[model samples]
Target: MASPALTPTTPATRDVVLVPPAIAMVWTGAGRPHEIVAVPGVVLGAGETLVAIELATVCGSDVHTVEGHRAAPAPLVLGHEYVGRVIEVADGVRAVDGAHVQVGDRVVWSIMASCRECDRCRRGLPQKCRAVLKYGHERIQTHWELTGGFATHAHLRAGTAIVRVGESLRAEVLAPAACGGATAWAALARADEVADVDGATVLILGAGLIGLSACAMATDRGATVVVADPDPARRALAVRFGAAQVADPRDVRALTAALAATGSPEYDIVLEASGSPRAVQAALEVVGVGGVVVLVGSVFPTEPLPVDPERLVRGLITIRGVHNYAPRDLDAAVRYLRDRGAARPFEELVSARYPLAQIDQALAAASAGRAVRVGVDPRDAHRRC
Candidate 1:
């Protein structure tokens, strides 16, 4: 006969029993992720903690993985954007800031963990460390099988910075701070820590989470902002987020003027977050000479465009690519959400919240581009505590 069942109390305190592996949406190399009933019960490893995920948001990169456009570790859990409360921690465990991350503290962790001894990390580029481990993108063979956020409980690995979020922010508002918001913040960091944005004309190529977040940050820096997106709803939302001007991407006038600098002063900065190859090519074309072009969208293989080598050389364009952000970027993201979340319609970006059982439905809406971000509660289907 099976042993007596383990029942944990509310919020899953440290002394709570080890519940069975909560449900997790496993991605197994397909156009959609498969909802697998994960084997429950996660034991805390040394310097590691078990976090009961309170909220998780679907990211565009996760969508790419589901669509097979981006290759990820198969048989892996697919979400990394999440906010949760620490329920259990191993002995000697503490956050990067040296504070003991106690149970019940609202938290968000950086997506990628790096070894400080790595050359890239030593030089301050941990995001690209030779042996970086990114949660939600790792294989099941990693330290913990339940490392991703598409589960009821996530294993917070060592070296992962646990940034304490302000208690006033809602779950949806704080969910993307580590991934989407952090990526946006890090990309814009190339602009002299946003100090140069004051009085500068900034044009963003997408109105998704990253783009809109960048718009808010840019406005905070006193930049004149214009945003472009084909979706009317997104354009409206962008305007609400502090864009001075909004334009449809298909507009001939907007496209022509974006990079030519012929009819108007070319934008001082061009941010490509549309995840579209066409947008990237257009960005290269639209910026004026000496302008900076920052690419944040994780656009994978697509039809390539020919480049005018001499034209590129003459423009003196500074094109930079940013992936999972550095630690400082995550700090900025938390601060941004904490300060401006109340005023901005951060939750508006989430069209609807869906239970994990209906994850396929959520993924459908996300793929259709109807929702900018979709919230998933693993406990929605099966509550563990």
Candidate 2:
């Protein structure tokens, strides 16, 4: 679709800045290569802001959508995990910390925008607001064509929870916080409700970005974490991120042995970050009495899980599923990254980097699952970080 003519920027008194056309890799449909286009000038409305994307990480969901494993709106901008500089902010827009947003501030925002007045928001479930507008999920519409992170510029709409991050943190370290990190924080928050993380025995089912994050956060809280993954490299990486023990998920004996070594016969909290059906069932069976199973990675369709009512009654297991995180969880994700990012090799997670023109290669690298997270820099195609 051809974009409209570029709009002129108003004066500083009107709180507007001139923004150049943005280069965007637009996803037209499943199994098709993204079309690279130069997006024309963007004019921000009330409670809106425009950002120049510095770096973005290709998320698992983005890979799934492109591979036709999941359905997403066609011709949408397909990235929600990114870090960028604020190029423009309209009146009444504030960060999640309640600080006034300013130009040139490096920031990350929640993937979904929720109307705070909705019933879901009033009930403390703002992430699922009836009128939620998620970044990278909606179709390309006029005046909001730069809604996702696969572009040089992103137009953030009202009700999006923005958070200002420190300049000291690298963009690669912070981009994934928008989705992977924030969702991990929410999953851990759910487990905390039934079983406290401090000094508890926790088992993480996958060693992907989210699982590694949970492992680090749980370890930081004094919990003993055991991470299980089929990949030896990921299992080794888990130790660097604070896993007490790492095991192959397919080896039931190894998982059981790891749990026993933690001085707990069963996990006090089991976080299922692998979307495999087998992992979901294993989460139920391995959780201790009164323990909670927080499922975060089963976003794709799979066969119905067979649950035994007697198991729930006798084991007293609490099963909770977390989708996108709350506004507060996004804040927690940033804080976690800021405080502990340097100590752990957070930068190592984004192993491969590509320029905006190479988005096809980036997505392929992510889909191959060879790297923990694949990065995209939307600046000059030849620019190196």
Candidate whose TM-score is highest: 2
Query: Least accurate stretch of 10 residues (summed lDDT) in model 2?
Result: 1-10
TM-score of each: 0.89, 0.94
TM-score of 2: 0.94
Off by over 4 Å in 2: 1-19, 381-385
lDDT of 1 by residue, 109-165 (tens): 989766556678789897776667688998765235676888887876655778888
lDDT of 2 by residue, 199-312 (tens): 999999999999999999999999999999999999999999999898988877788999988787779999999988988888887888989999998999999989988988
Worst lDDT run of 10 residues, candidate 1, spans: 1-10
Question: Whose lDDT is greatest here?
Answer: 2
Note the Cα lDDT for every prediction shown: 0.76, 0.86
Per-candidate clashes, comma-separated: 6, 0
RMSD (CA, Å), candidate 1 to true, equals: 6.2
